[model samples]
Target: MSQELKTKAHLIYINGEWSGADLDELEVVNPANGQVIGCVPNAGEVEAHEAIEAAHQAFQTWSQTTAYERAGYLKKFHALILEHQEELAQIMTKEMGKPINESRGEVASAASFLEWYAEEGKRVYGETIPTHTQNKRLQVWKKPVGVVAAITPWNFPAAMLTRKMGPALAAGCTIVIKPSGDSPLTAIKMVELSEQAGFPKGVINLVTGSSSKIGKAIMENDKVRKVTFTGSTEVGKMLIQQSAHQVKRLSLELGGHAPVIILNDANIDAAVEGVVASAFRNAGQTCVCANRIYVQSGVHEEFVDKFTKAVNLLKVGNGAEETVTVGPLINQASVQKVRHHVEDALAKGATLLTGGVSLENDGGNFYAPTVLSDVTASMVVMHEETFGPVAPIQKVETIEEAIALANDTPYGLAAYVFTESVSQGTRLIEQLQYGIVGWNDGVPSATQAPFGGMKESGFGREGGHEGIESYLESQYVSMGIN
Candidate 1:
């Protein structure tokens, strides 16, 4: 029994209080050791409504407050996030089974969003639309869209919450967040800090529960003026349909089967490291995780050898351990899904270059970091989002073939290109069909860039100035002097 396996508290935050209802409770398990670490209260319909109503009421006052005042409180909240980051990181590691290094990075990343948006609160700019006549002026202003319902996923709990909450709070919108039940503890703590920062009552609320019941409640509620969701494409589509009758504003960051291409002229060592980091970080559960690797024919053998060796050397264990390189998948279901994908690929004649099975002795949801070569386009592992620590490598003769294979999937969330030639990188950037592209690098997003997807990957943006626009309603105002 390690410190990471110790039990902890799990309570919902609504209107600045830690309260639990009579609803069903679910155990928050440490995937690293199969230990029950905490119990989260599942939000029933009544409790969900309570959170919505609280947000609705708080919006009345929060929306009317001066931008400077809101910014002040947010700034304080940002400082508090820094003060308590270590504790929050420990909670994230125990609850979600992400490595301590990664967990700490996530906490810091989460805090950065709060700090960035606090400053951005003062910069939500509106403009005077130039009028046709000198005596008349058209003024356009941005206002909060009232109560917001934000549903985030489990992959990056802390960072995802901050990304959605940052813009909503900056725009003066009160929020009722339904974090993924699998990793709800860290989010609960964050809401507590927001309350301590002097935010108005009900301005930020947390509701945890089964996805179907809580998701439908938020989607059907008229009080929730806007919805921001980060999850699977299938669920995102359903949410859009549910919100159709009310025509609620939506921002969805959905599923991704991102592609990474390595040209013959690129640096093989750096490219191998980039692929491994981008693919296996967080156990390859990230929506933006690289699932497809296309290496040019000239360097295909060398790249595969280096990649396989690197992956095989990774250490998998408890997330709280300082030496662990890879942690367990979030749950048993994720483990099974990854297993199925790899098995299917093997059945389809994909060669297992390094690893292909789960580790039995770990007593956790631990799958070995896997690499497969000789993968064809028809293999399931090549097309589907294998949200696990598995990378499938394919050989390509030309850049055109690489781009075509990359864009063949129904998902177009993100893609990466590695090439030494500036001309080749530029060409690939133009040809790749994904929404966000990394040239000669593996970086997926920045707080300053717009992040979203195309095709079946869902719609809307999550960062940059464009993110705030999603929470605003545009009304054209006309004035004339008589």
Candidate 2:
């Protein structure tokens, strides 16, 4: 099954067909062992434009599709995802270095997004407006925004693309997607599923290339009414600048440096579990993963010891191996970035309790899951998005101090608070500027909830009913009474 998946992973899917570009081809390497896995077409401006044109042309008919019909196609897609679960998981693990189990879970999560949106599509209802005129009635209707160009990141490649594409298609919008160059195979394979589910030609397209060239192509195309991107804050800012030239509808899910607070009265075990899961999952490559952990002074000593022990227990190795919990960083550059952050924290007088060094002879871009104590806001790890498995704990004297430290960063993506008191929880909920807040848990949002950011993290929601609404426009119709 893995060999079969590899055969189809090399090509790009454009306008219901698989093909290579006349331009360069990107070498897709497995980060775990540094092996060349496959080569996908390094699409250029021409190919990107081709995809936009195809989606634009198809939107006319696809937008005219009834909600019921679109739901049917989405249901088929959901089933197809499960059918290709193993292969999809392997492709993601090989390409991005996330553990196989994690990748499999991601595929299932991606399918759930499709399933949720399929039913949610039926509920894209608009309200009727009351007017002053006695002889007329005003009714509002939801209409699909035209072509959408979706750009997704590498971490959790399958889920990210599906989360964006699921709702876009459910809202009757045709779309073209540009997956991350490091992990295009998952997106390309998803396109195959979309085709097998009998989507009309041109309704779905995939392009791979220099993100700048492809993003420019997406921005400049007038037919593309909406743009949805999930990646770094730097790139998100760049897209915002580019979108200024043409006022296209936009949804940007960018970087995050989320904070998790451990109050004095919080259950030690539960808080420890949340901290470990959020800090080390996907080797901390996730955007919403916990950044700085603020532990109340009363329990700081015990919390640090527990966290240090947990970090040391994690096994770092190839993602394909079932025993691996913490996998290699995506590539050499990512490893260097993690190393730099750890070194900076240590140099700034933070104490490394466990796992700061990269694996010396691991035969992979592997960095150990690290834990640091006495982390201050002045440290580089606290200020920037480490995007690595390094949990830095900061001791705070009070809830006020914790909130102040948590909200200090420009990012407002997701935050976590562990508390036993209702008053403390209420304060955390109201005071935290993050878009999504988790209480006693690490992850706060899911397929059934609207997830986004409040400040520099980015804009627009991407799940539940609100998810599809981003891809649709409201139209008003008036009828005169005879």
Candidate 3:
């Protein structure tokens, strides 16, 4: 397996030009091997304002452009992603430690967001309402909401970026994006492609680093009409509080401690496989990764046996290797966080069904795919968003108990239910507080459906018809004929 990663020059994409920051360069490390794969500008307050001003300036004309015109740029952008799919995938894998093939698959799936929104832009239709008076008519129009700030996380770098940008651009809103420091290369490349795709100057801008400072500027900037963010629950709350004064339109995709319920009627084999896929994919660094598995007591033993074996069979190594199903965590902090969850679970009387240790000796931020049985609601793993390759299995005697346990967390992002009976699946779906529900199969995330969470998990949807709506505000007009 090759270890060398490309150098995406440390520059900010502002106003259709690659601009240098006044601040120093932040080294982009390859999480798999701790090598400096590249560097990106640690954009300071000045650069942040520049990007915001640029987006604000461009929004005047960009927002007036026809949906067809905006979609054309997005279509070209989607094509450009595919044109350099392999290159983008390589950069993503190196920067974030997701397996190589997973990175490629992400890039491919990511293109769909652009394509979906490009076409969906045409369907941003308004409605006409009938009034009691024949002479009166009521009509509504959806108008683009000026400059948008897209603050994204590193996990699923390409997909998350596109999901935010695709809808924003399609809605004729100019965007200023701030990608995670650990994985800016893919975001940078995507923006670079956007430039080549014929987007007008400042239609899209990317400013890297200075999370707090840049975020503060974004919140304070009156020109920034809307904001979309994907990160921790705490950070999302902070952004909310900061932007409160501005009353900006905000869309947040925050933390999730998603649950997977395995009922007695479920296919143990299929349920186990889905659990592994949900909990371990992307080295378990996902907002919606299944954090807790509730198994019916009737099949608990058999399910644990099969699930443990499946997890153990996964190869753990650098993502560059095809056989390595689990790669390193984004960095050492992820290693520590995952370890903290495992240790906390064990302290609370959880029994390790399979692996529960880190591979620190292997020289990267790697942790074994872990499964913990005998877990209970009192354990930290039960309530917290364990954003790593750790799965805690708790046994429940009744569907009611399973549902209660699943809804116990503060988050309500995504949930999974495995059952042979359709009614049972629908019941769980209706009862679950989560925004997205998967029955018998995990949601692989296509662009056609809405994706988001209810309650504290986050506000606003990121995909589907509703995705673009967040970037626009409605205006109602009631007219009198004659």
Candidate 4:
């Protein structure tokens, strides 16, 4: 693994060649123990433009390839991801601080996107319209949009890239990806596999370094016809505004403050299990994890008791450790943010049920899996996406109140409800006002399902059949026949 990291480390891939070996190096730190794992070139605006140029040039030929040919390349890429899954998982654990098991799961999820898109590329269907005049024929064809600029987040480094890259490439479009600097190693490794998969030169490129300069450069480039981003709402808004100048296509999967509601007729045991799994996965760093949990007054006390015990069982330590379930936050800023949210909740009269403080002597950015009760709607934790392991739960008197509280947020990414009554579940699902809803399940996202948000959570879907459509443009053709 060390040799693998050194082989491509400190280099930026451009036009199918590795450069920036001597550029200003930025250290990649292991959040687990504050160790410098390796260094990568701090590429800036210049490299970003170069990558865009390369992708633009490649798109001319790459977009001409048949859907079967494009699917072939995607299939190879998917296989390479699974073949090198172990190394990729290790790098992710080192750089991003998710547990080894979770990292492995992410790797699998990442590969699944490529595999699904490989077959889905061939399924991009066109439409035919019957004309009023028998002599005229009209049809619609789907074509590649153009060069795509993908900006991915560090939380699910591998999965986020493949989710965007798979659809873009499968649609016969070239891509220039800018992975988060905090977790660029995993992205670099994935790009390396792309090269080995025999993707044509400039078909796929990656640059790492200052996000601000690269983002600005990509937005300013006329060749980049589409920009896809997954991050905070503030940054997504900026990208949306930047796209207006070129009328560039945009797909933004921004911030989420997901809510989980447990009704009076809910299965308390299953509800507790579901919440624990969803809330603590990736240490609650995921955008869809349950941040605000609401339970009906009839079963609030019992649910809280069981939920606290489940949260306490989560092992917190370095991700490299086999037994550790929860790892450190990506950096100190994340740690501070989590701490601030917890403190604010407590100051606002929320009760700390199990864990609230950072774990001492852990030698890493580890926080105890915390559960809070008596939480109110006005608390900061209720309003903001904590992006940590702290679960702030409130009690609601009725189903109507639970639904109201869940939908009060500006985000409409995901929501969950636990109820044994099928009629009640159906009614709640219809009125949830979220892009994705889980009735009795905590984790509802799958590779085949359309995953995205509404409202402030941003627009566009990433999975199912809708994933590949974002990278394609529809061309209407009208013909006069004798």
Candidate 5:
């Protein structure tokens, strides 16, 4: 199966069949070694429309299927995912450069979404409305939103796609997906599994290639009732503008510069562990990663020392190696961005404690896991989302100062706080302005939790009950009796 997947002529999936095999292909390179492992068809605007039309046609029958039937299909797909977990993880690590262990975890997390939404599909209930007049009967009905367009990022390729696909399918909505050009192989393979799971033709469609062309086609199509996207804020905003004319309902999970606060009363070891896990996971490519670290002045020195030492222990190399905790950046552009942030911080008087150099060699895109101290708000790393394994620590004198600094940014995707005091934790949770909060817990995301953001982080939730709700619409019914 692994050999077949690697050698397969991956193509655009539309109307439940593989196609576009003759089109110009886009090479899929391994970020760890810079080898072209595979190539997918470079679909354009015309192909995007064809996928949309397929989804629209399938919705007529798919949306009418009983929720039980939808759940069954989702469950079958979930089982197939588990069955092929190892192969899926390998493909992900080869194409995207996350450690093999993390890639396996991502596959498990992705499978959970299918199992979860399978159950949630059965629970998409409606309510009876209370009427003022006895002669009139009123009710509220829940329904699938219609054909959906899902635009996902490359970070957690499998998880991101399943997160959107699970709910959209279980809600009885047909979907057209546009996976990131950098990592479409995983998406293509999943779509293959969906076919094996017995999903009806056109119920799930995937197109790869130029992002702008495919994105424009998906957004501008009138048949597409909703758009669900997870990517940069700039791209999300552009999608919003493109879909404006059609007034499409959109669920956007955009950018975030999540902040972590460590108070003097917190367990220094525990705080370090949580921050290291949250900040450096996936080589810090996650949206909710600990971008900024704020430590109270009383314990700032101890915290920085422990954190820097912990970071130094991480082994950075090709993700295929089992011992490597930190992998290369997805591409050279990402490496350059990480380098720029580190350079700018050092120039601004921020002290680098460890790991500030690049590990690029023989086409490898590696950067060292770095830590910076004495960072201030003026530094670019402090304000911008450094989507790399770099942690910048700042010392704050009081809880008020810490909260103020954390909330100062426009992004409100996620924030973490480490404190032993119940009062302090409560206060920080209430005062922090973000969609998701972690109280002494860095890895806070779960398949059953409401995951999203506020302010510039973008609106809409992607997990738990809210995830399915995003693909549904409510209709009020009225009846009159003689």
Candidate 6:
């Protein structure tokens, strides 16, 4: 490891106290340099159980609070996030190798979730069921699901934590958050903010550690009423199996091999720009990032030329620099994974249209934004989620062929289509198998919309009113009067 001074503390929060576990301390490295930037307590089964117990205790009172009362606390929390957005962004950049600009955006996105859900807390509605003209009436009620365990990935730490926690808190559910060990500093600081915002003790807890131990503890805990996770499909499958035994409610936002389709009549310039931003932002670490692109045969060659040029021009450097467009992969393992995918694709006969090599920069986990053309369906990069700055482009004869190729992958979290014809765009949108479809743009999600996936990408929705419902359980009551 490079000799960089670590600035973050190493501790885990349980039962409203910062404590050390018997597990080893995990050093947080900056992916841009492979330098130590912080350390977090690598919690084991013991700490995980403690967090669950804390959340369970907090839920006794938290879940009993009025929706209006919960809304007040969330509003304060939202304002506190805004007050420290810059500090949180810097922590995120140091912990995860995201460009400072993108980190700032992540901070803003986190705050938006809190603000949106704060208002939603007061609006959770229950309906009275209509019955036949008799002396009987039926009422329905929605109540918090007690304790929740939120497992988030390192790709977008701040936003992922808030996206899950905001709705859970708004719905009067106490939570235990287990952030990825790779990037836990920002989340730990956010937990500090929760205390400062005057949230009840034990209402929100943070635990960091190895995935296997922490995940098993959360899934096996009978006190945890629900489990929410965002990560790879393989891990998601294991969590689902574990949750099955306990019959716990689960919300999994798993791996995605998103597709981008460029039509013959589309605006090439606009589509190319969208592809560059969508596929390479945060160095293409996002789950919804477009990994597969199918260009209509009529404009495939031209699109490839422009897309390659754009990838070649990206500025790869430290995330702190304002001019840097692409930052390093989150870790050496991630770099190796990207390299493996690229090398496998080339070995399988795909042609490298632009970049296909790692950078010579010292210490940084940097890989050049790469573009591969003449890619076939058989290549690993075509079917798998390459969580890095690698784009695999393929050509299709028509829109029907493009859609067919897009849907060929088992993962269907998100899809992108660029076209000028409104009628054609609507038709394509209706046929796409993805949960979220972007039309003529690369934006996959907004706070006002629902986001999740179909197929193996996992289930349950987040954002908007639907997000709040995930933390609640419904009960119907019927009464008769003689």
TM-score of 1: 0.97
- The lDDT for every candidate, in the order shown, is 0.86, 0.89, 0.89, 0.92, 0.92, 0.88
**Residue lDDT tens for model 2, 184-219:** 888888888888899999999998878878888888
lDDT of candidate 5 over 1-482, digit per residue (tens)? 23224535288889988899889988888888888888889999999999999999999999999999999999999999999999899999988989999999999999999999999999999989888998999988999999999998999899999999999999999999999988888888888899999999999999999998988888878999999999999998898888789999999999999999999999999999999999889899999999999999999999999999999999999898999999989999999999999999999999999989998666889899999999999999999999999999999999999999999998999999999999989988899999999999999999999999999899999999989998999998998887
After superposition, candidate 2 runs with Cα above 4 Å error: 1-5
Clash totals in order: 0, 0, 0, 0, 0, 1
TM-score of each: 0.97, 0.98, 0.97, 0.98, 0.98, 0.97
Expressed as tens digits, the lDDT of each residue in 1-482 for candidate 4 is 25235756458888999999777988888887777888889999999999999999999999999989999999999999999999999999999899999999999999999999999999999999989899999999999999999999999999999999999999999999999988999999999999999999999999999999999999999999999999999999999888999999999999999999899999999999999889999889999999999999999999999999888889998887889888988887888899999999999999998888887634677788999999998899999999999899999998889888899989999998999999999998899889999888989989999999999999999999999999999999998999
Candidate 4 residue runs with Cα over 4 Å from true position:
1-4
lDDT of 1 by residue, 301-348 (tens): 999999988998889888889988899999888889999999998999
Candidate 5 ranges beyond 4 A from true positions: 1-9
TM-score of 6: 0.97
Candidate 3 — worst ten consecutive residues by lDDT sum?
1-10
Q: Write the per-residue lDDT of candidate 6 for residues 1-482, one digit (tens) a residue.
A: 45433333467888778887456788888887777876778788988898898899889999889878888888888889889998888888887889999999999899899989988888888889999859998988889988999999898898899899999999999999989888888888888888888888889988888888988898888999999999999999988889889899999999999999999999999999999989999999999999999999899988999989888899999898888889998877888999999999999889988778788665888999999988999899998899999999998998888888888878989999999999989998888999989888887688878989999999999998899898998889788988
Ranking by lDDT: 5, 4, 3, 2, 6, 1
